[model samples]
Target chain A: MIPDDRKYTQEHEWVQVEGDAGVVGVTDHAASELGDIVYVDLPDVGAEFSAGDSVGSIESVKAVADLYIPVSGEIIEINEALDGDPALVNNSPMDDGWMFKVRLADPGELETLLDAAGYEDLLGK
Target chain B: MSDLKQTPLHQWHIDHGARMVEFAGFAMPVQYEGVLAEHATVRDAVGLFDITHMGEVFVEGPGAGAWLSGLITNSIIKGEPGKVTYTAMCNEQGGTLDDMLIYRLTEERWLVVMNASNHDKIVDWMQRHLPAEGVTMDDASDRTGLIAVQGPDSQDLVGRLEALAPHVAPIAELGFYTHIAVDGPGGEWIVSRTGYTGEHGYEIYLPAGAMLAAWEELLARGEDLGVRPIGLAARDTLRFEACYCLYGHELSEDWTPLEAGIGWAVKLKKKAGFIGRDALAAQKEAGIPRTLIGLEVEGGPIAREGCPVLAGDREVGHVTSGTFAPTLQKKLALALVEKDFAEADLMVEVRGKRLATRHRALPFLAARVKGDPRAERALS
Candidate 1:
């Protein structure tokens, strides 16, 4: 299910705004499409990236996909738990699977992202 | 999707919620549950696979054995009836055309099973080389269906078939690489004690029309036995772990059987000289230039197929197949590299970054295909 609290990208990533920071992770549809993620290459905390820059990668049993940053920000935290158990992405894509927390460069960028209804339309759900 | 071919069990796969993908021109199931879970099911318990896309060719007549012996790298004439010999067919240059299994039903009858992608090519090659007399070849691919039941509990799941018990040996008594043919109401069924997976398994070849019933029956009977439906994704991982050479990946026209690490299947001294015997002999005398070796990459990034293998900035070779081995819990890759750098310090270039890798043995995991039944029980 597409969560209403988070804004999503066409690349299948979602970001939930919390104060000045945004928690990012792939959507459930992306996790299911990936098919049993075995490894997640998380970006380093404090790493800076521009919008649409590849932050890291998600490696599944069959293939791999790059995780793109939706907006310019500096990484403040990464989920270290994924290093030991990446299947969490498939098990809890909307909650415990949060990949990284970024200090948002422009909160206004959140408005440009697709809301639940918009994302559902994009996915033709 | 309309252009792709479908197996007789295609609807069953769809009804069971399998994710389908295009493979070898056929619309096949890539996974049912998930690759990791399906892979684990095969390694730990049992799994069924609909491999109906694979090709089956029948050769009959008095000269069948001799004709086949001259075509394959391995000696088919030397193998007794009921035995399945794995061999490679090659061109005059010793480049592999396809790797397949030849089942000798009798002195004058043989059955060849080959890769689905190479079906047309292999059949064309065989037809061109058909002898003027004493041998007849028939391609039965479209009319045949294949089902593979693999894993530790495979024997128990397959042995429970009362229909098979009346026709063939008790599944437990069937020797490795052996098969028994039965004339059933549907058609002739050939149950072979052979499989691509390293686990104990069996491959049943029957009429295409009868596949759906068998598949449904197996699932119905295997529900309590922890048997799950496997797919192409897990099939690759399973065969990769077993160090089996996938045609396009490991065995190809670009790499000979010797360099591909299937030299055991290539018998240069067989009584009948094959198409590429001279070339393979010459290559062996000159020393193999490159060798297929297993590698374990450090870190999360996988060195996938086509990734360059470098030895201190010099390109050595490329990865043929790589994945996060579900059973070993490590990132592993099979690379075709210069024989000199096979054991040397190497790095695989993945996504513009070089990752350190260590040379590992051919199979990342020990194959338990033929061993004490107790050993399988111990693992389970």
Candidate 2:
């Protein structure tokens, strides 16, 4: 829900950069709509990706949704903890529930995304 | 699109964060807190369900007593004033008209609860049997709202409410399949000591006007005490775990009780004939062609309805009800197969993958009763 501290994709994914690495995950609103997060699919570590591409998919108990990458980059690491506990996405989508980390392909491309305030407005919040 | 029905609690469910979905021709809450959590909570503590969409029919008058006896498969007149009997309305051929519960309130009066989708069909069927100017059939579904409180602690939870205090009686005295008329918050109602979930619980049949207050009362007291508002998702899983047969799943226009494993409800010995009595009796003598059985699957990852039941390479049957049985922690399914193959060793094809499964006697989750057969078969 912290719209200002992070950048958002049109797909409702949020990306927060820490130094040179970008942490990617879904927003709280997305998880709330999906209900229980029974399964999470993440890209393999060291997988190369470009901007505006689907990274993987997420499956709730009732429905399935594809996860799109907000900022194009190489997936440097995946959150292994979610393999056992998918509810973390529902409980704490921002902190311990981050889905993956990526090294930015072009840091300048980040400017194309919406800042926290803009994302909030896009959500009518 | 506007024809689907909505219960009195429909708006309340939406207001309380319930995800609504269309089911059985009624818009019902599919889940509120999530299916797994609600399912677990009901098994451990308590959960409340709005089951107002279920149909209710009142049979009364001169031969209203024995007329229903001839129509239904259970002994409706023999029960105590408050006692309830889970029975089926079957055709002469034993094909199920509808599986229902008969609440015997008096010698000449009884209330039958039926499935929502089959309400009209059951009513039409009952009218066909109405004695010549002697009995009357009244559809009370429009005026009633039923709420069920289920789980290990449900009895204690429901008994604690000030509004429900008058209905409270000795816990042991209220046996299974019984009901009573108490000074409930909404007025006189046939509060039946019955529930679809295999736990010890009560189903309150009260006036629709009092539904909101009664719901708020249960939910208010149930807050944070592990009593949750369950939805259709939890309802299906809970009933499936209890091996309770659903209307469209186990019994349908084409299927019969002998095949559905509910032959005990048919009173063939009564010497009176029902719609399908002769057909059922013939099936009994000739042996059923197919039998419904429970399958406990390993590594199938929650078998669901329509998963094919495979006998080696042949597709013999398919699952009618299936889920990752919350209590058993294993994928369980109910399926109809040839009578000979409905045995211990069986396999099911789920998602084009053949998986090994075992035929376990139904009611996978044991209701904590003194001499429950499920208790003895519990996988410890």
As a whole number from 0 to 100, the lDDT of residue B98 in candidate 2 is 91
After superposition of all CA atoms, the RMSD between model 1 and the true structure is 1.7
Give TM per candidate. 0.97, 0.82
Candidate 2 lDDT, B292-366, residue by residue in tens: 888877642445677888887777888888766667766678998888787746778754567888877776766
Against the true structure, candidate 2 has what lDDT? Answer: 0.79
Give the TM-score (vs. native) of candidate 1: 0.97
lDDT of 1 at B237: 94
Candidate 2 stretches greater than 4 Å from native: A2-30, A39-83, A86-89, A92-125, B1-4, B161-164, B170-172, B221-225, B344-346, B369-380
lDDT string for model 2 (A7-91, tens) is 8887888899888988999998888887777667688899988887877777665556889888878899899989777789999
A24-115: candidate 1 lDDT, tens digit per residue: 99998999999899889999888999879998999998898999998789999999999899999999999999999999999899998999
10 residues in a row with least lDDT, candidate 1 chain B: B371-380
lDDT of each: 0.90, 0.79
lDDT by residue (tens digit), candidate 1, B1-380? 78999999988899999999999999999999888889989988889999999999999999888888899998778778888999999999999999999999988999999999999999999999999999999999999999999988888788666557575455567788888888754889999888887888899999998888888888888889889999999999999888899999998997799999989988899876899999999999999999999999977699999999999989999999999888888899999999999899999999998999988887776667775532632211
